[model samples]
Target: MSEQVIAAIDGSEFSEGVCDYAAWASLALNAPLCFVHVLDNHSAAPSEQDLSGNLHFGAREHLMEELSALDEQRAKVNREQGKLMLEAAQKRTKAKDISDSTTRQLNGTLVETLVALEKDIRLLVVGKRGETAHQASGHLGANLERVVREMHRPILMVPATFKRPEKVLIAFDGSKTARKGVEMLARSPLFAGSECHVLIVGAETAENHSQLDWALDNLREAGHQAEGAIRAGDVDEALQAYVQEHGIDLLVMGAYGHSRIRHLLVGSTTTAMLRGSHIPVLILR
Candidate 1:
C-alpha cells in the first residue's frame, strides 16, 4: 500500500500552500494524499438561544423570532461554500497527478480529529495561520505544539510563505530521536539524493566526539550521504548560522530533549530554532 500524507487545510491561501507541499512530498514518496478541514464548533455555535422553550406562550413567540434572527445573522458561509472550497482543494491535488485524494470536513476540535487519524498518517502538514490567526496574540496556535508532543507521526509545520526545500539539515545529537530522524531520511524519498547535512553541536569531550562519529556512521550506512561538523556555541545560534550560510531548505530535529517542562520554561534549543529559523521545520518526537 502507498504511504499516506494527511494535510489539515482550511480555505485560506496558506492552506493551499500546505496542500502544494504535501503533494510534493506525497509524489516523491509515492503516497496518497488527503486534505482535511476541521470546523471549530465553538466558532459555529448559535450566537443567541431562545428562552422560549421554558417561557409562557406569548413571550415564547417573541423570543423565538429574536432567536431566529440571531441565527440568520450569525450564518457566515453556507454548506455550499464549504463544498466548493473542498472541491477546489481536491482539484489542486488532482492537477499534480495525485488523483487519489480525499477531502473531509470534520466537526469538533482539531486536536480530536488529528488524534483520531494519527495512526495511519505518515506526515501531518498544517498551515500556521487560520481564521484564528489575528486572534492568536503571538502564540503558535493553541493545539499545534500539543499535537507535536502527542502525535507520533512527523509533522511539517508550513509557514505562511513557503518554497520547496532543495537541501535539508538534520540536527543530530546521537539521541534515540535523532536516530529515528535518520531512519525517516532513509525511508523517505523526499530526502533521497538530496544533500543531507548532519550537524553535531556541543561536542565538548572525547565521549561526545565518539558519539558524534557513531551517529555519522549510521547515516552513511543508511545510504544517505552526509557531511558532519562540530560547532562550539549554543545549538540555536549555530543552527541558524549554518542554515543561512548554506541556504538550507529544511531543518529536521527531535522535538524535546531533556524534559518538556524545562524546554517550555527556558525553551529548548530546538524551540528557539523554530522561532527564528524562518524555514520549514520537520519535528520528530
Candidate 2:
C-alpha cells in the first residue's frame, strides 16, 4: 500500500478539527488521506447480569438467549455508528479538496490497528483529547501517550479548534531525536510557508549555541526563514512561555527522549509539553 496520512476519528466534538488538520497535512505532503475509527470491542461488550433471584433451568436458558441477542444488537449498532463517523470524516476531507481519501472501521484497539498499518502511514493525526478523555476532567487522552510511545512515525495531535499555522516552534534539546525532528522539518513540505523558530531551553554554552546555529543554518538552507533562541528555566515552562509570547501556531518536539519505563514513571518532557500547550503538537520519534 502507498503511504497516506491517517486520521483517528472517534465521533467526538474534536473529530472535525482532526479531519481539518489531517486534510491540511495530506495536501501539504501530497499524500492520500485515510480516516480510521476503531470499535473498541472490549469497551463495548455488554455486562453480565446477576440471575440469582430466579435460577430455574428454563429461565437461565432464556436469559442466556436474551444476553446473546443483546450482544449482537450492540455490535450491530457499534458498526453502524463507526460507519457513520468514517463517512462524515470522508466528506470533510473531500470538502478540503482532498479527493484521494479512504475510511476504515477497525475492530480492535487504536494502537494495535495503527501498528499493523504503520508501514503504509506517513503521518498520524489524532485529537488532543479523545471522547473518553474529554469526559474525564483534567486528563490527557489515555491513548495519546501510548500511541506516541509505540508509533515510529510522526504524530500530530490536533486541538479542539483548527488554526492555520503561520509560525512554528521546534523544541530542541540537542538529542539525536531532536536532531532528527529538525531534519524532518527541513525536508518535509508540511511547514513550507511557516516561519520556523528553534528554541533551546538551557544555559548559553558553546555547544548549545553551536547546535542552535547549526539547526538554524540547516532550516535556512532548506528554504525556510528560521531563527534560534536560548532560554534558561524549566524545560516545559520556558517552552510554553515562549510559545505563548511568540504566538506559535504549532509546536514540534522529539518523542521519548528517555526510556518508556522512565517516562511512564516520572513523565517525559514531551508529554508535559503536550499537556501544557494549547496549540497543536507534532511529536516526532
Candidate 3:
C-alpha cells in the first residue's frame, strides 16, 4: 500500500461527492489522491465467427465491417467521455488545494478494477448510488456489497453531497471483527479532532457492558473524546435514532463482525443503516 486514496468516480450526481470526499480524505490522511473512473462494461466478449450464412459473402463482410466501425466509434466516445470526466474531477479537487492529485480511467467492471488496484489503495471513496440508479430514491450502487466483500480495506460511502464531519458514531457489537474496527478507529487519524461516540445495540448484559466499556476505554486511551452507550431495539432503528439524536456526522462500523454483529452486513442491518444514514459511513474490514 502506497497511501493512495482512490475515489471511484462515474457520470452520476454522487461522483461529485466522491471527488470532494476523496480530497478531504487525502488531506486528512496525508495521502495522494487518485480518481478512478471504471466504465460500466455491460459486457460481452467479442466473437470472431463468420456471418456469411444469412447473406451473401460480400454483403456479410460489408455488414461486419460497418458493425466493427460503429463499435470502435462507440468505444472511443466512451473512453473520451471517461477522460473528460476524470480531468474535470481532478480540476475540481483544486478547490481543496489538491493540485498534485492524479486520475485513472479504466475500461472494465468497477468492482473488479478497484479490487485489482486494492494493494496501493489506502482508502476507497465511493457514492451510494450510480448514475443509472434512477429507479428508487435510495437505490444502492450495484457493486456496493461486492466491493465490501472483495476488498480488504476501509470504504467511505457518501451521498450526493459532502459534509465536514464533526461528531462520529461507531456501532460496536462486541464481536472480534467489531472490536477490530474499534481498534482501527482508535488508531486512525482521519477523525483526529472529532468526537467519537461508540454505542452497542443490545441488552445491557454484563458482557455487553464490558464490551462497551472496553471500546470506550480504548478510544479514550487513544486520545479521543469517546462516549459509549447501550440501547435496546432493532439494531438499525436504534442506530438511526442515535445518529439523529446525537447529530452524528460520520457513521463508522465493521464490514462484518462474525459473532454478535454478523448480521450487520450478512443480514440487512448494514444495508438499513447505509440507506437511513444521511451522513458519511466509514466501513472497516
User: For this target, which candidate reaches the highest lDDT against the unseen true structure?
Assistant: 3
| TM-score to native of every candidate shown | 0.81, 0.91, 0.89
Location of the lowest summed lDDT over 10 successive residues in candidate 3: 261-270
Q: How many clashing pairs per prediction, in order?
A: 0, 0, 0
In terms of lDDT, the poorest run of 10 residues in model 1 is 261-270
All-Cα superposition RMSD per candidate:
4.1, 2.5, 3.0
Query: How do the residues 1-285 of candidate 1 rate in per-residue lDDT, one tens digit apiece?
Result: 344798887755567778788888888877788887776646665655546576766996777678677656544353455667778878988888888788777766788889898876888887655546635434565567667667877888777665778778887776766666777775678887777777777747786677667766766776766776778777778888899888888888775467332263234222556655567877776
**What are the clashing pairs of model 2?**
none
lDDT of 3 at 152: 87
lDDT of each: 0.71, 0.83, 0.83
lDDT: worst 10-residue window of model 2: 260-269
The model with the greatest TM-score is 2
Residue 68 miss distance in model 3 (angstroms): 3.6
TM-score quality measure for candidate 1: 0.81
> Alpha carbon lDDT of residue 179, candidate 1?
68
